[model samples]
Target: MSARHFLSLMDCTFQELQSLIRRGIELKDLRNRGVVFEPLKNRVLGMLFEKASTRTRLSFEAGMIQLGGQAIFLSPRDTQLGRGEPIGDAAIVMSRMLDGMMIRTFAHSTLTTFAAHSRVPVINGLSDDLHPCQLLADMQTFVEQRGSIAGKTVAWIGDGNNVCNSYIEAAVQFDFQLRVACPEGFEPNPVFVERAAGRLSIVRDPREAVAGAHLVSTDVWTSMGQEQEADQRLALFHPYQVTRALLDQAAPEVLFMHCLPAHRGEEISLDLLDDPRAVAWDQAENRLHVQKALLEFLIDPAYQHA
Candidate 1:
């Protein structure tokens, strides 16, 4: 209870993080059984998006409504954040009006700046550097399909973007192992890598990284703003594609995963993504359940029946 902000996976402790996941599972099961609950009554979540998204927008709004709370969408064009106003000032103001703030923006520092000034909880819907909410769904999916995350190995192949960053952070907390395969110049942040020195292992070969891993994860070769460099990236990242041959190096129970809106033949092959062991769809659906649990936790700290 009383979580002031959710800027990154590292923002939460290991136990708190697991609590949210377990609570998410319970909420999901309840919803499937036709149970309804108003856990966040009279709460309003302000969702600010400087970047475009389909899943982020829909999951958060729907999650809020499902919990008996309301969500207000704020696009870049609709807010003064676009015109020139500082996020600090906006954060101070919005914190007074809304119960929580969910921001999907460019820089991680922007959300940090907002959290610094805001009194209410701020969730990192997404950022150029980390996507904690997405990983919440990911962790839930891991637990649901694999039963537990501790001691499991996860392999990441492709551009080391926000999702990969959060995955590393999740591994740091959950006692899991992670191996990443990215092009020479496209490696993850050096600071993050250093922070994970003892906990994580890095590799250059996609196949080598995926070897014996329980879950294989990947994202697009080119992220949203990197469209201009898509051609070059594709050429350079071809070796990192999650193909059937690559998946063969993983454990027999290895589950394939990718954040939605995949490029089919680019970062991952269609056959691999559609494989029976692929848990991409379950990962996407978990987004809603995790957010619902998060909302309930943030709104009522005293309500601890998880």
Candidate 2:
């Protein structure tokens, strides 16, 4: 199987994701011991970011460097893509010049178009609709901490945004129990939820959804363009915040997680984020390892290992 583009969790099979996670775990261990591999020696990754980022840009670039590959960053202002060039044309041209492409943008359709048109594999760095790479890191972290994630419950207690969408996909892939707690009208995208139905539980009450869960995850109450609704969302999501009191509602060993750039006292409490049970930093670090595995799987000429 080719690992060219990582579009969405739904695009991968359970076995494919297992291979990715396993490779990521091994790469992480090797990197920690100062071991180095040149699987993508001389390969170049073209990075296109129409949207702004912190983790996605740094992690992918860092991962490429660690794997003996190079990356070129092209922001919206730096490319023809800014001047009415079709996404398909841009992707086609980039593919011919680079070994792979990592795009962080708005629409999922744009990346889909890029993948459909490009000769090289296209990785979805992030899109408004999904964040599969983040989920890869998250899945690996879960396994690293708990041995195995199957059947364990993970509670999502915030906006039904991209992060929540990715978590739902991960739950289905691993056969784990996923419970999402959002305000009445703030539930996850119905299409994704329906696609993973039977394997997911949607709840209106944060406490009820979190009860008995092994992991508690949350994201910002107001995401990037949603800052206009900050005051309103703050009021709506107040009860959904992962506080010390709410943490008590989950299984005793429950751990807290967040895709960082955290809002100290909003979606999660400072205490819970700093708690010994929080593996947030590990999750951050895994982003680099999993990204390296993904690049190797996509660009390495010899299919020896990812």
The candidate maximizing lDDT is 1
lDDT of 2 by residue, 209-306 (tens): 89999999998998877879999999999988888888888998888888888988888886777787788999988899888888887788686541
Q: For all candidates, what are the clash counts?
A: 2, 0
- Model 1 residue runs over 4 Å out of place are 1-3
TM-scores for every candidate against the unseen true structure: 0.96, 0.96
lDDT of 1 by residue, 1-306 (tens): 344578888877888899999999999998999898877877899999988988999998998988888999997699898898999999999999999999999988999899989889899999999998889999999889888888888999988898988888888888888898988888887777777746677788998899999999999888988899989998999888888888889999988888888888888886876788788999999999998888787766567734
Cα shift from native, residue 199, model 2 (Å): 1.1
Residue 96 in model 1: lDDT: 94
